[model samples]
Target: MSTTTTVVDIAPVAEVQKLSLRAADPSESKPEGKAPEQEYRYAHLLPHFSEDRYPPLEPYEHVDPGHRALQHPNPRSFLDTAERVIEITPQLGTEVRGINLAELDSDGRDQLALEVARRGLMVFRDQGDFINRGPDFYLQWGRHYGRLHIHPTSGHPRGYPELHLVYRDGKQSFNFEVDDSITTTVWHSDVSYELQPPGLTTFFLLTAPPTGGDTLFTSQVSALKKLSPQFVAFLKTLKAVHSGVEQAEFSRNGRRGGTVRRDPVEHVHPVVRRHPVTGDEALYVNRQFTRRIVGLKREESEAILRLLYDHIDKSADNQARVRWEPNTIVLWDNRVTAHSANVDFRHLPDARHGARITPQAERPIPALEGLDLSA
Candidate 1:
């Protein structure tokens, strides 16, 4: 493959050099009244902590244990710290655990995030601790990993003024009325219409119907791996039309009293994308926003797109379903999975309310990179 200009950012190199020099100097003394050289020598060998000088570590005390306790009343059965990988079959949509999202430290959060990314989707049942903060809490957790995505037109209700609320019962909500079809759609990645779409989305379900409403997620990586090599090669060469304008327009019409206008929004992205953190390549196209393939005639594009969409739709074994419980939360990687809501309980009297925080992607991974495809 022909290589493009490799632009390397060197801003951090200077700081790294300074730290190295400081560490090399054996005579570099500690601040007044600090520990002796012998005592601090061992600290320098630590990964992040240097023995020579000590900057007060940030207190983890701000992380309240009560937060974890509230989320997991009985930690024994509900909470397990050891890493776990479980497949959620059709029969088991929900995974009940004591993993408290609110109590996760930086390392814990990273571990959980990776697990969620790997598993496609995860559920935290009966998260009463999160309900009070509601959407605000979700925003915090989402932003912890990356920046919150601000909609091109609308603003978030609380955080970013430009991010429009997608909730139907609130200031800017998606209408779940009898006539709405947008929210009831099947298997799709969120906001694929953008050039660089969202990385992850966190949803907090504050309320749920008495029975039958659930969310399903399908693994895109597994789906792509099953495709024939010929089809995979063809897909790699093609780009799909995804439109933000179409979704915005749909949202405008779907929400009651929403003033947002529909525009001719579209973007083209590769059928497969490489994740930044995990370095794993995943199937990236979806049926919802993906309209046609570029570099092909209309008929050819339609035929190819139809087949690909059908493949993604029919791969039921790769999917995981989650039955909602009150104050429950779910998070999934938008880059690697497609999801749908089961609206069987739409007629139920109880309202399902929740907030979703989508983090913006830094860049789109091109198809023919030299980096390892399996990371």
Candidate 2:
């Protein structure tokens, strides 16, 4: 595939160089000093982090997590450092214990990435130690994997552009028509509209209501496998268009108060994408961003997408749920999973707030049969 020149403004050369050097030498990737402690008292304020103008972007390339995992001399064994790794379900999530994410070396990080690639999501509990290490340490840990992605319109803390704030106050009335369940409209991978979409996302819950704020993760790999062979084959031959126009418009004229720095984008991606590390096929379209299948008529695309979406929604065996607690961190690979939050806690007195750091990975690769993807 030909490489597209980058809009240097989106990802600066110096920034890319720094992340590259860090990836090459994991020992040097650790942050120098602990960041001053910050209180989570400001959960109610929705602060938009945006630049004055965002230059238009063209497609660019980067080494994806799968390729990077393969480069690790021993990617599979890094999990041996964990005290215990428990599979949450036959197909979807894993709960890892006794591993401090802030302390993982390069090899450990690589293996963790590999594990998330293979498993849809990994949950680590009682992560207050890592969470308290502050944004500086957290950001550095994310950068070690890849160049961090700045969310086009999400609220960020005052100085940190890399930290996307997930703040919710229970008092705000419902903004849209009631769906009866949030999962109906919210199941999605993070930012699928980007040329190079997000790979691994770190979501750390800092505060939570005592109950009712759980996230549901669906394994696209498993979702695809459950289909009949003929259907899967047909899906492989198709591409879908994912768009960011709704999100951009929301940022500009909706509740976000015009926080968009990067222009909203749209791209065509394989309906079935190949996992970079595991060499597995996954259903990639989500209800949130995926607009339509490229070659189909409007009705045909809607029918097909609706079928896939319903499959993902009803495949109970392919899903896993993570109940949240303060200081719990869930790391998920967007390449293989789609997730949604249970907004049930939104009506509770307590606020639901968290910090998310998503690192961009390679452009989606079509899992075309007979293609030499080994390169």
Candidate 3:
């Protein structure tokens, strides 16, 4: 009883179609009666409140462009609601409760925007209802301010050009320490490259990882405030050129792709930019886009820019980190703060996807009360 002769052709190893070598084999599970146990570990993000950095901020009250209080009859009624405002960090961000962002009316939105303008950003956690509402909800929600911005390079998701996507699926691996929130791991404004930088940029975290992807935001208000009056006086006399060329070359995913603008729009604005409504000053130069300081030598420009960049990145004393959870909305004023997405999550199966909308744009202008370069 001999077996029939057979011939088999083996395929080349190159054609195995990319499988993870570390993946366990089909038979690698525990025996029928035994199971492996997962060790429990937990961590919490600490929010720092520095008196020197935050001092004490007054609640923002909306004053109409005409400086009339007609639009705000019962302004104090906003804080009177069930909403509780918690100052997570003195630098900029605040966590607000008792008010449902998804259910706010025109008046409620206006009051909310006031706090957002004053605080730099307002974070709404535990917003499960808004999870499936999609971009349409956010578009209408943010429309209370102005039209949502459409990025020319970062291709908007399908028909929603107004909604810039901050969807990240970085290294689907894991760690006990940190998670990779957003891939653009740099200290930069949302779109300083634009002729009109975003005034208000809001994001809703629909999906969040278990441990990583914490975003960090620095207060330009604090950045400017901490500087010596002499430095601010010097900065007021200077103009920095923010180039859109490099940014327009990259896709929404932060890679170099899409329609490369031949000559990206360039805007020269003072380093100390004043908020149009509140008249608050923010150090406008960012690490990524503000290329040069006009009227200065190359060396001088580099030195000054490097110093500013370092200051923005190192303003941890005046910065806050947000550990995102599902249905969390972070509304940050791009006009007043710079943000950096931390990618500390190595390769966790963690996925962080969100919708970001930039509401309107503002031409950065410096308040010229008394500008003297030489003190």
Candidate 4:
């Protein structure tokens, strides 16, 4: 399997590195005698969210008395401090308690990188960044991991080119022709059409509804593991066409602003991918971006894709849900998990908005257990 270099493969190093980050003023007031770090602060925006929107609540603070929480083990990989991690489930999802997502020191940044790998997604509740300042902190969080990824279609935030917009107005619908029950709500790994897709995608939920704006997650590792050995071996022999254009957009309801590139970028990837950092194998197919299996009849490809989609998405046991709170941050590895943000609140009164940060792309490398990934 020879690899070809595409426009997506080569990123502008000089252009990306030269990008400036918004920082604080030397004359700005600080509490007591503390000093400011070199990174960006709340210089660009104001605290606009009303207090009633999202009351910053602590973990178990809002819970009823005598309601016990799940006891979880300390986080395993890439953690600078296990003391902070509170695992939500054995499969995936966790909250790295008692830390400010809006700001992180050098050591804190390193711990975050490890934490993202250990727990497929790390949730930070009641973050100051999402509440007050615009996407400045979110941009810093992205650069802390790697070179920030700029979306070709999604527009950037004001003064912050690194941050992408992730907003959904409940007043609108993708396909008004069908029932709200039949939505384009299929689970997907973010931007899988790119040969080198986003390594990590972070979402800072600035405004969540009074009820029902939860996002679902499933471990692709768990999905692949569910299949038999014979099935796994057979899948490794196939490749799939992944495109984020018209076909994929329909699955997503439709693109924001209804802008579509006539010739959208596309790529081919293996059914199995090895994590660049963790080296774990994951099922790479998703109903949203993956179009068809290569070298197969259209009928054969659709049948297989449908089967794989059901296996990964339909199983609740392999999944976890994050009920959103205003100022909540959820960062997940695109290499290992598939996620779907629920639109159950579409007709409801509340509106949702968030700033997204995606680190540099990780070229998908195929691997399987007991087999050499690079042949």
Candidate 5:
């Protein structure tokens, strides 16, 4: 069969009717999968727990076997190492230098690992080239302890299925616009919201905004030191309910284009958690996901939680703010320090982005193993 050749022009016509169309009316686009930012209205919900109403928090009175109270006064000696270790905060956190992490010999790596276990945190700055190696570098450093954390659902990096990305996006992706501009607010250790929280969080920042985006770290041990004697005693006897349900619920169904449903896991951790490595006790309550005091009445729980939250949030001399330099890697003991990122740079189109490797801890321990709480 012979077919006739035909030409079809796909180009637009040169000239047609000159119809004037009014500019398409502009419409505001609400970000997808995010709730409208609402003002926090819980200030009035706090209960006042004065000394007359509630019992005072007493000092710890118990002592463990083979450990004596006030005998070893210097806890800093636990972190001393031959390698260069510089204190970043008066109470906690240290930066180690004069060693190449990329090429650490087996013995050198082992020594560094021991120091990290003791110091709570170890920082390396001006290592732009080292971070370029990406997850491999983290694996190299973390292999001795454990593998990296794989998040159950959200807060993971894009195109890096193997590596968890801790970033915030405006619309379709995970959004937290309602709260403060910072990414993480309320002083907390990484993944403490989970039933089994990660042990250590190692973050390497490849890019940071010119201004803002500083990470503030404070020692929970120092926080415990500042608390009134009565509060410490009260916390020792209480347990707080921590749940990942709130964030999991939001991620799964609360917003549009949400992820799969995951049940909230609840675990009760001590209000004062002791460090398994360094043997220092720290105030462990955080404002974000800690729901209630397990045995207390609702009113009593509210009263004490308000006090503890305020105590940790205050800006004090013991707090240290690290202005991130490009390619700086910070490894913090999730068991010891509470950190919040300064989010002043949210207005910028491109802000801070990095890869984080969090390893799960074997178990949580008290800072002072032998301290008596019943006294």
Candidate 6:
């Protein structure tokens, strides 16, 4: 693979020709077995409440959790203790083995934090120990990173407001149905509309389907690096407006029983953001939340955003797909990655339920060039 960091031509003729000439793989069809009807494993954990019962939380500032990793006395010590640390891809995604997240010492936690910041995502399997410890431990572990963010609209489990429930039943259909077509994939950095967006996000699978229900992640750093430097420079000068209006509307329309704990928010973030720990540039605008580029006409912003979205979606080299299983956890730095849930098993009766713990981080900062270190 080319290790050059400099900008290259976008989709050269040779590359196009090579892609066109690629041999097609033989199609193997497997019969879809009937999935047994099942109830959500952690349904008991969910709280019963009316939509108007949740009191609104006041907006507040948050400190970036990555700061602790930066100040750690020994940031790389966890790698020594792990049985193996496999980098899944050259750009992003890591799988660490032989370490239980529940028993992590302060140093181990700090090191893990550093590793997550360096690698865009980390995968841990057989996390039964951590999962069995329950939501109290989960919330505490997340709080160690930063202030836990209570989602404005999502359904959370009872007694644990910090954990956002990602649950779906067989009876419900997705709202994206347009003329009998359902759009399942929506790529986004979680809640980018917030004044302080999520930093490190933890998603723990309680019950996964027999097959399917994988999540897609793409490295924004790699996405930004692929563009020409001139284009990158132009993007760095711009900011995009991210709004939670659509999400709030979805909640209010009885999606989650008309739950709206807090009002929807809107904020402008840089088109290119600088990761606080790695100092890498990442293309920060996302399709779900980002509405328009600041200071641009509606059509102009749409055109530019459409181009960037296509770049992100078409970059196969920069993406990773994570297959889920029960007792599995995937943690990622929300600042540098955009993720989408694969709802391939939507038609099936098998349930895919998970809980996410997200810690709000510092305000989005632009990845500007020509910094004066002397100051």
Best by lDDT: 6
What would you estimate as the lDDT of candidate 2? 0.73
Return the TM-score for each candidate structure: 0.68, 0.82, 0.74, 0.71, 0.69, 0.83
Best by TM-score: 6
- What RMSD value applies to candidate 6? 13.2
| Candidate 1 residue spans exceeding 4 A from truth | 1-85, 90-96, 134-136, 152-173, 176-183, 251-256, 261-264, 370-375
Candidate 4: residue pairs that collide: 78-114
Candidate 1, residue 50: CA error in Å? Answer: 50
Off by over 4 Å in 3: 1-76, 170-185, 251-263, 369-375
List the candidates ranked by TM-score, beginning with the highest: 6, 2, 3, 4, 5, 1
- Cα error, residue 341 of model 4, in Å, equals 1.0
Clashes of each: 14, 0, 13, 1, 17, 0
lDDT of 1 by residue, 270-373 (tens): 77776655656677777777887776899998887787678777777777777766556787878778887676655544344445677665445755464222
Q: What Cα-based lDDT does every candidate model obtain?
A: 0.54, 0.73, 0.61, 0.61, 0.54, 0.74
lDDT of 2 at 331: 95
List model 2 lDDT by residue over 1-375, tens digit each.
Answer: 001110111111112221111112223434568533322333222244445565665555666555666777777676676788899999989998777777777777877888888887999876767877777886898886677887777766666778887654444321221345534347888889887888988997655666786889999999999999999989998888888888888767745445678888888888999877788899999988999888788999999999999999889999999987555789999999998877776666565556788888888888985533221
> Which parts of model 4 are misplaced by more than 4 Å?
1-84, 129-133, 159-161, 173-181, 247-255, 260-263, 368-375
RMSD of 4: 15.0
List the lowest-lDDT window of 10 residues for candidate 3.
40-49
Candidate 6 lDDT, 14-45, residue by residue in tens: 12221111212224343479432222235444
Tens-digit lDDT string for candidate 5 (204-235): 65444456667888777787888788768867
For model 3, how does the per-residue alpha-carbon lDDT over 1-375 read when each residue is reduced to its tens digit? 001100111111111222111212345666778654321110000011111111211223223221221258764355576557789887788887665667766676666666677888788865655545555776887666765556554424444556665433343211111224333457778767555667766776444556777888989999888889988888888888887665644422234223332335676777888887677888888877889988899999999999888888776788998887555778888888888777654465445545677776555667665433221
TM-score of 5: 0.69
Residue 53 error, candidate 1, Å = 49
